[model samples]
Target: MSEPSGDASGNDLRRSSALVGAGILLSRVAGLVRESATAAFLGTGIGAEALRAALRIPNLMQNLLGEGVLSASFIPAYSKLLAEGRREDAGRLAGAIAGLLLLVTSVLVVVGVVFAGPITRVITPGWPEGSARFELTVTLVRILTPGVGLLVLSAWCLGVLNSHRRFFLSYVAPVAWNAAIIVLLVSVGLSTSEQFTVAQAFAWGAVLGSALQFGVQLPGVLRLTRGLRLSTSLAVPGVRAVVSRFGQVVAGRGGVQLAAYVDVVVASLLAGGALAALGYAQVLYLLPISLFGMAIAAAELPTLSTLDHEDRRRVVERIDTGLGRVAFFVVPSTVAFVLVGDLVVATVYQRGNFSEDASVQVGAILAVYGLGLLASTSSRLLQSSLYGVGDTRTPAIYAVLRVVVSLLVGIAVMFPLDAVQATSQGISVVGDVAWQVAPEALRAADAPNALRLGGAGLAFGAAVGAWFEWLLLRTRVRIVFGPTRLGGPHARRIVLAALAAAVAALAARALVETIDLHATIEGLLALGLVGSVYVLVARAVGVPEARELTGRLERLVDRRAK
Candidate 1:
């Protein structure tokens, strides 16, 4: 009967999660730099929209076949084998999944390349069939297809590495991917000013970078999985279990990815910069989820998979503890994004072609996304727990439900928002239903990647869908597990501390309101002040995760001093 907040595995979970977070932090920082460079060179122009759509289009293959699906389908059964000291079986499981993924992804890559045009049409129907923007998006999609396949294999490598408790390289390996893009973007920026040419060059760079990312992980996977023998046989004993889970996880991941795809499609229909603005906001929005939420869930999964499902007490304690850890970090993140997100966006992106106006648009989208940060992060852990307990189908069902809700809401809001034109005179209506009757009227507003607020509707819809999924998950876990509900046991204190922190942040901002300060410096002062206030208040409120973090910092300092 271990308490929800104080489990024996807490230390190991924290250490492992820290490792995962550290790796993700490095990769995400590099990703931000890559994004910043893209914004600087392309701005929120037609080139930027095409590039963002192109990058995401072939990523359909990766999302269907990548880390989220693999983490659920492959990791649990594989981890169980290793925990039982069955390295040979573990290797066999790894090899089969890798071989299967290779076969599936290779075929998809070829199909993606061959049918890139049709796929592009479906993905970005907003672009006319033979327009310059449309054709360019088609071409970039073809270029990035094979590269995305390579990323799928890289995810397989991650499954092997994480199963072996080598969290850093698998999570950090994307640094190579990001770095390669940055290097090419810089080189091309120096040589040329052509937007289409820049887009093409970066697409090729992405392909090369994908190869590097996969290459870096293969050696480690090989070393750890010595008994591995590659095959496509479905007859392997545990292979059936993996495949069954894989199907359900694919459905789950597919639904989630589809929500994103639909958002892109709708954004394409909005004014020009909506796609790029959405892209910018998402890059920031996903940071905390990847760093804290994904990290903690990843660390817990292998351990959770090895636990006895019949012993519900142990499982509940693990999940509740992890959720609390996630909430303590994410609550304040939500506040930051909502209350002072413009500062965050300006600090990262308000340079070169990424104008102050663009930053404001992106920040507005981010604030809506922030309102759902807690739901999204909490759902990540709940989904992991469901996967660990072999209840993959439940999450899949909810994921689809979430998407349905999101699409209904998103489409309803998007068209109306699109009809509302932004003018020099400060916003005017382009007829209440002009998007339905006047295609020309909507196109007049688009302006090839110009700023628009329509994307925020998609963000708002997504936030609503996220809460629905989280609530369903929270209840389902309670029913499935014996006596406990899935949630952040420490959410109350964490949220209160965050509210207090937000108040202090507001005061700091007011104090600096009239001062002439650069976006970066102003952001640092506000974020730092808010963060410090959160930590101190959380400590006073006796939030365990905060106390643990502070205690760890103090311990490290003492050790360094000695």
Candidate 2:
């Protein structure tokens, strides 16, 4: 358990990050396929809205106690015990935490199933009682609660494997989860004409998927801790430490989940398809954040947890490198979302029953969400670093502040925007190519105002809160590490590269549009052109990370050629 040499540590970090990123990439692609299928079947209607709400409600359990909380509290404690060579104690602590998680999740699952109606009311007040949407949501929530319990256990497995530095299996395991849903969607196609029945099938598929997700990771966890056994005893040496930290981490994660739930509630009150539109946009927004931010942070946490208290310099170095790498990828991704989000949304979700109107709505929401991509991703690494140093309380406090800010801003913006109906004249004033594609159904005089701009307001509020959180986190890191080197020259170079790449991408998109090509084909060409230009521009700017990435790609290409 001794620390690797400094040179070795850097390489290990990069290699581990690459592995995790590969797994996330596959899992995310599968996830996108699952979402695409959902959109094709449900088409952002009332059925889609109900299913989205139901999924979010039970997900509260996993979000509150799942990977984020465990990474912050349980992983660090257990990892430290392992570093100290207390294998027996580590095993016991792991078992105890697992048992406790199951017990609590089981109780919550039962309560969630029984009180599905009341729970739905609290989370989504816009849906009327006795309505099909409300009833379907309640039913789906009941069926999905057990799956939440299973996912909680899967998260426990993730904590174990991560602490042991077995990163690939745990990260790759979600493919099973996504695959289950994909298979179910494919099998039931055309067999069920009703959206309600299709949604029911999806709900059950999700439950089966959760079980497979957990089952796939169990063998790895067992292999890592051969002697571990389930126990409810909290009397182990480090068990109390984990328990105490768990509450703060849970509160911190809960604050984040609360902000999301607030958005859901606000979106629900807006229009029938508002929540569904937000859900679709969110999947696209989260892609880069997961691929870059979570992959790097998750890889670094266990290593950081093992650092000596006197080695503040090492911790500072890791933070800088991780943040820079994250920004390198995410900045361009943000640019893509802002510039070509309509194309991206249209390509992904505009087929079948998902109309051009739905695409426009989701595209706008994505553009707004793009504004917060850097802040949101940066906050993830900052929080992970703080958790590494055993200071969970500060992040928890700032998280609560972020929730308050998001809620206030959401209300202030959403209501006023919703009041202004988009008349024919008003629609002309909002001149954009993306808007030209909107269907007649969305542009009609009787269309709901909420469908026009409410989702964008929600997105804008979330962005404001995300930047606030990032500011607070960055300030704290400076105080601890003495004026972080993350923002001066390096940031300027990244922004310049991203701007150049975005311009090239825009040109590529224009060329593609001029020709008679499908939306999907146009989007792919633009993305490829932009991505290639980004790497070339970044390399030309003397960015070391960019050069390193290029070198890796070259080596990969050579291997393939061989």
Candidate 3:
């Protein structure tokens, strides 16, 4: 139970992050495919919007009682007990938490199902009452609410597995979740004439998927924590501690969720497809955050929890390393989104009912989100570090502040943009440009205008809030652990590398525009070239991380040659 030495801890951190990242990558790829199938079947219309709203409405339960809160509270306390060699106490605490989460979520799920109509109405007041879309949303919410309860249990399993450093199985178990959706989409093809029918199919599939996700992780949790029993007692030694921390973390997560709900409410009032468009953009935006930010943060939290708070140097070192690794990957991802997001969107989703116009809409929102990629990812790591050190209140305070900033910024930007028509009249391009290939159905004069800028406004507001959160977290980390090694020269190098990659990508895009290549092919080529150029430039600028990455690639190549 002795704490890992500094070098051993760093190596373990990297290995754990790589494992989690690999698992997440597979799950995210499956998720992207699931989304593509959804778009192909439902399109970015009322059906899609209703489905998205239904999913988000019940997701409140999972967000409040699920991974974020559990990771913040349960993992820290459980890991601490293990570190102290209190195996029985840790197992009991896990069981107690599991029982408590099941009980609370069960009630919430039943109430949610019973009152699905009212909940859907409150969440999406813009939809006309008794309309097909509104009715569909209610039905879908009822189906999806039970899935939320299942996912809360899955998250508890995740908390236990993570505490024991069994990161891969818990993190990758979501493949079952995504795979189930894909199977449903493929089986129920787009031939279903009614959008509501399609939505219903997806809802049922999601419920099944949540069950599979939890089932896959249960054995691992049991193996890691033997003698685990289902106990509803909150009086257990470490259970009380976790519950105490859980409340603040839930408040923090609730603040974050409220900001999202605000976006949903505002977007609901804007246009028919506004919510759906926002959902599509968020899927693309979260890809890098999950792959890089969450991977690193999730790996480091358990290890960081074992660190003594008095060891300022070790705390600063671990946090700084996490931050740098996050920036190393996320910065390029941001540049990619800003420069070639349209091409990426077109490649991924512009087919069937998902029109070229939908790609443009999603891409524009994604570009705005790109502006805050670094900030958002950094804030995640910073929050994890705070949780590791048992300082949840600071983040909770800032989370509320972020919500206020997002709401204010969203209103200021969306209303004006909604009034202006978003047309692609002046921009002329050869080949498969987003505007040119848009379906006439999407461009019909009778189509809703609120769809044009409402999504963009939400993205902008989120970006603003994300940067504010990062700033607050950064300042707090500095005050608590001293200035990190990430800022001075290291930051400049990252910026320069990102700039070089952006230029390379832009140049590749320009070349593609002059020629007659498929947008997907052009996007892939551009991304590849940009990524290569970034690694080279980063290495030239003396970035140790970049150099280390290059070294790994070289060793792999040498092995292949051998």
Candidate 4:
């Protein structure tokens, strides 16, 4: 096998990380804007709920089968072949995978379109009785389902580019996605409601967004590869291996999708914008994890794959060393959401059709989700490690474990705490949420009540599931590195750093509250001051790692300034 020269290997990792990071960053911003716009146009209404629910089908499928899993399984194999000097064969593998994806996704999209109503019935049966919400959802799914194909193609392109250590263009595709959606939202707003329903416009935007995701990367892909020819031959050598790996990737990824499906089922029982609340909450929770945790995961993958057996030890060590930094970045962000969740919801979404009540409700969900952010972020990195090692099944196993625990926890917790009823005790503004996502709607509508009966079941499920995931990670780490060598001063330093960050975050929260800066300009100013104070405290509290990060950041700024 031909090994990548030192310079070439280093350059490859850097370029891919930068590109994927850039694309993810852009996509995250655009996604926030899309969520904001959707909230504005539809609010927490039946329309919003239906739209969010419908959108999930395509998105869930995409996430489950497209990005992480597809890339995880495909990239390693592709990279291995290339490293062995099998360029033409690698290219052929890419084309074969792409052709297979095209065929499979094409079939799925058609099925989705034809059976949209039945799918909706299965997924969100209680979508507001006697309302056209159900019908509209069906319509929207049909319009958006084709996106599955485009996105699958985009994923293939991204994986191919990542294999080549080219990442920038792929990352920017999301910028295009958001821009397209923003345009659609603006256009719809400018026109009369009679002209086009927001649901229809958003669906069209989805199709356009997926196209943009594919289109933005075309030039890059074309430059990297000669051309793609659809291979009809099933006897393609690498095709079976890639497809089988993809299946493992899909199973591993399926847990997250299943978790999402559970949310939908729960929200369906809850009725009246429950889906929107959960959707909004999930996105808000995902932001920091995406920003920070993903930065490390994205950077680590290609490097991990190329590491020699001995150097692979460093791969695990790098992950451990980076976890502190990841926590330092992510913990505070999660806290910020927890502390100012209501203000955030109010600020970004509480206008137009989204009322103060809706903001409060979503805020509550966001707060609970905050507790699990660290677990979620760490899980992603852990899975990335598994991918790097070409062991898709381990992560798949962990995912299944997580889902089972989540479901069990959800069931166990819902029966005892009935936390929904409990949330109403003090927060009148969000009291409706307890009522909204309740089992009553299901019983009243004669729908299955498993979701509501399973209430707090989902939340507890997440908590328990996250624990199992964390355990899975520890076991893996132990196997990689002996148990005797694990958990000492290094772990202590990280905990202390997290403690410092937590304390700083709490102080920031208090200052923001004291200045009454939560609702207006004063709040923004206070938030800035609090963030500054946290940095200072983090530095003083022996958070040298965090301090180093800030130092590196300032050096970059200084260089830019010069």
**Could you give candidate 2's per-residue lDDT for residues 1-562 as a string of tens digits?**
4667777877887888888888889989989988888888888777788898999999999999998899899999999888888888888899999999999999999999999999899887766677787889999999999998999999999999999988888888889988988788767856876878888888888899999999999988888884587888878777788888999988888898988888877776664466788899999999998898899889988887777746777777777878888888898888878887777887788777677677767877798899999988888888888888898999999999998897788767765454333321332223222312234344222333334556777888889999999999989977776455543237878878898988977898689768988767877777777788888888998877789999989999999999
Q: Which stretches of candidate 1 lie over 4 Å from their true place?
A: 1-7, 419-448, 482-487, 555-562
Question: 201-308 in candidate 4: lDDT tens per residue?
Answer: 888887898898898887687677643567745566577777788888788678768877766765565534456666776777777777766766666666666666
Give per-residue CA lDDT, model 1, range 251-355, as digits (tens): 988998988888877777776678888888999999999999999999988887877778787788888888888888887778889987877888888887778
Winner on lDDT between 2 and 3 is 3
Model 3 residue 413 CA deviation in Å: 0.6
Candidate 4 accuracy as TM-score: 0.86
Please name the candidate that would achieve the greatest TM-score relative to the true structure.
Answer: 1
Which candidate, 1 or 4, has the higher TM-score? 1
Clashing pairs in 2: none
> Order the candidates by TM-score, highest first — what do you get?
1, 3, 2, 4
lDDT of 1: 0.84
Ranking by lDDT: 1, 3, 2, 4
* Superposition TM-score, candidate 2 onto the true structure: 0.93
lDDT of residue 314 for candidate 2: 70
Model 3 misplaced stretches (Cα beyond 4 Å): 1-5, 421-451, 485-489
